[model samples]
Target: MKFSIERGALLRAVARAQSVVERRNTIPILANVLIEAEGDEVHFRATDLDIEVVDKAPAKVERAGATTVNAVTFHEIVRKLPDGALVNLTDDGASGRLSVEAGRSHFALATLPRQDFPVMANAEYSANFAAPAPVLRRLFDKSKFAISTEETRYYLNGVYMHVAEANSGRVLRCVATDGHRLARIDAGLPDGAETMPGVIVPRKAVNELRKLLEDDDMEIAVSVSETKIRFATPEITLTSKVIDGTFPDYTRVIPTNNQKRLEVDASDFAKAVDRVATVSSERSRAVKLQLDEDRLILSVNAPDAGNAEEELVVAYSDEKLEIGFNAKYLLEIASQVDRENAVFLFNSSGDPTLMREGSDDSAVYVVMPMRV
Candidate 1:
């Protein structure tokens, strides 16, 4: 393929495609993005068999053809090209190498047959819907921190996205839990989305989709089937195979009748959790929360190291309660509440506790407590 594309445009397109390509690959073609030029546009497609991303940009096409080159080498060459220069990509169809020329920089990279690229077969999506970028972004951002990394429980490694009944009628939801804690979020349901199938999107796909939902007002077109799901913006389309297993019954883990309430500033709680956890052992970061009347003292004690304590004034009228929870877990969940206060609902020192943003029910969370 022969095409003359601007340096900036080429860099942006290649960078996006290459970021999806891992550093190491068993298959040679999997490490390269197929570059095709026709008419006035250049298309770049990259895939790892399970996940495929295609990006397109405007280019000056001299010859409508296609070729493949190492994604990393092509990206590095384009990145080093002088600013504002024009880049020309040419393949003679016989040399088996693609030549990249831009100003004083030039590269000749080995090419692979475009036919070797594995593209996902088109599917008849059972459901197709659109959501505002901000809405989709909120669903992932608030829950991603809690995604499980346990490979055995593959279903817990991704956010569970589906339709649910909320106080305000039906709403779209995203829930993720590692059994220790869970993050459940809800947003207004979009049109034509009530019948959408519940999909346990793999962790990697959620991260890739985040990059496309940065613009708050941009609308994303989402297509779903039993085994694969697709999320697309105006310029890019990302397709991936969904996890085949069923997610655990996460609702049973979220507490419902916790009565002891503690309300404290979210930032203050997070800072205290961070400081106290530093003194505890890495394997057992149990921070003891000593609450009495309106005074709350958070402390962590490790035999080998030292102890740390931070006191904060809260709005708790309950009797004295001492509870221990994983410091890392507390810190992570506390950071998610983007408000002045975080309300904790506790049953006892050992029972699972619930947390929320002040009195808001839009987004709720549950954290299992640890024994001191």
Candidate 2:
């Protein structure tokens, strides 16, 4: 294989692919980036078995062929090369070594057989739909905070995507929960998505998908099957197996009858939660909320560390009430409220509380209370 690619173009493609390659691997080929050159394009493929990323870029191909090289060493060498240098890569197919040349610099990397790379089998997707990048961004951005990292409940470690009924009619919904808190978001359903199966996209897949959705208006094609899911754009396609487990019934955890309502500036509330939580113990991050008439005070008391309290003028007319919740959970949920006011609806001190964007029912959240 022999090809010459522009420095900028090569960097962009290799950087994306190499990130999927882990630093250490028991299997030698897993640490290499598979480079295939044909026509005027070169494709770079890297995988860690579970995830694979392939990126293509325009290159001047002298001879069309394929080879694999250490991903980290190649990336580091190319990164240190002088800017605007044309990079030439050549491999004789028998030597099992790839030579990289740029200006007066040259380095040889051991090659691995391309036949050893593992590829995920294709699946018959039952549903295929398209969504604008911004819509998908909001869905993941708002809900990712609630994704659970607890390994035992692997189903909760990703955002659940499916169809559900909303106020008007059918809507696409994404929900995530970490047991203590839950985030539920709804977007207008795309055409032909009514039969979409509920899929728990693993956490890693969600992060990789976010990178592809950076273009605000780019339309992404989504395909889902029983065991695997694929998301594709004009330049790239990503496929992964879905978590083979049932997500707990998140709807039951959502509170519907919390009567006491308190509305406060979201930014101020988040800042107050941030400041007060600093004094709380790490294990039990409990913060007490004291409310009366039109005032709300947030306080945290840690046995080891000093206590902290913050007062803010709020829009509350309910009788006096006190409730406790994890300071970290409160801060995270409050930060999600984009606008000025975050409305909190509380029941008794021990039950789960509800929160939403002021009076907007489009987005709803629930947080289980903690004992201070």
Candidate 3:
């Protein structure tokens, strides 16, 4: 196999594919990327058993063929090469090695047989739809922060994407929770997505899909089946197996009739929480919010450390209420509010609190309270 590609283009393609390759692999071929050179493009395919990514880049083909090489080594070599330099790759197929050559640098990396690379099988999708990059980006970006890192509850370790009935009509939604906090975001459903089945997109796949959504003008083609989910563009495709377990019904946790209301500047609130949290106990990092009339005071008290407090003039007309929450959770929830004001609804100090951006119901967040 032989092909010549520009350094910048080659690096971009290889970087995308290699990110899917696991650093530690029991199977030798699973650590390598399969490179296939065709008429005018070269394809780089890499997988870590659960997720697969294929990136295509335009290249000048000297001979159309395929080979496999260590993904990390190839990516490192390409990244260190001089920008704009022409990179040539070649493999005789029998030597069990792939040659990478740039200006004056030459390296031969041990190769695995291309046939040994495990390519994910093609899935029969139950729903296929196209969504603008920005729309999909908002859905995932807003909710991914709440994805559970706990491995035992595998179902909670990803963002749940599905179609649901909304006040305006049917909408596409993404929900993620780690028990302590939850994020739910909704977007207008795309045509032909009505039949889409809800799928829990694993955290790793959600991260890989972020690269494809960077281009605001790109339209992402999404395909979903019972067991797998795929996202594709003109030059790249990402596929992953959906989590086997069912996600908890997040709706039951979202507060419904919280009467007390408090509206505060999102930036100011986050800064206050962060500052007070510095003096909080490292183990708990609890911050308390004391609210009455139109005043909100945030305080953190740690016997081992010192205590700190900050007051913010907010818009709260309800009766007095004091609630304690994890400082880290409050910061995360506040950051998701794009608008100037973050509205917080509270039923009591013991119940979960709901927050939203200004008056927008499209994106809502729920945080479980903690004892100070």
Model 2 alpha-carbon miss at residue 96, Å: 1.2
Q: Give candidate 1's error at residue 89 in angstroms.
A: 0.8
* TM-scores of all candidate predictions against the true structure: 0.97, 0.96, 0.99
Cα-based lDDT at residue 235, candidate 1:
81
Name the candidate, 1 or 2, with the larger lDDT value.
1
Best by lDDT: 3
Error of 1 at 361 (Å): 1.5
Please give the RMSD to the true structure for each candidate, in Å: 1.2, 1.6, 0.8
Worst 10 residues of 1 by lDDT: 276-285
- lDDT, candidate 1, at 217: 79
> How many residue pairs of model 2 clash at the backbone?
0
Which residue pairs clash in candidate 1? Answer: none
* Stronger candidate by TM-score (2 vs 3): 3
User: Which consecutive 10 residues in model 3 have the weakest lDDT in total?
Assistant: 277-286
Q: Which ranges in model 2 have alpha carbons more than 4 Å from their true place?
A: 281-283
Model 1 global lDDT (CA atoms, 0 to 1): 0.88
Candidate 3 residue runs with Cα over 4 Å from true position: 281-283
lDDT of 2: 0.87
Using TM-score, rank the candidates from best to worst: 3, 1, 2
| Cα distance off (Å), candidate 2, residue 177 | 0.9
Clashing pairs in 2: none
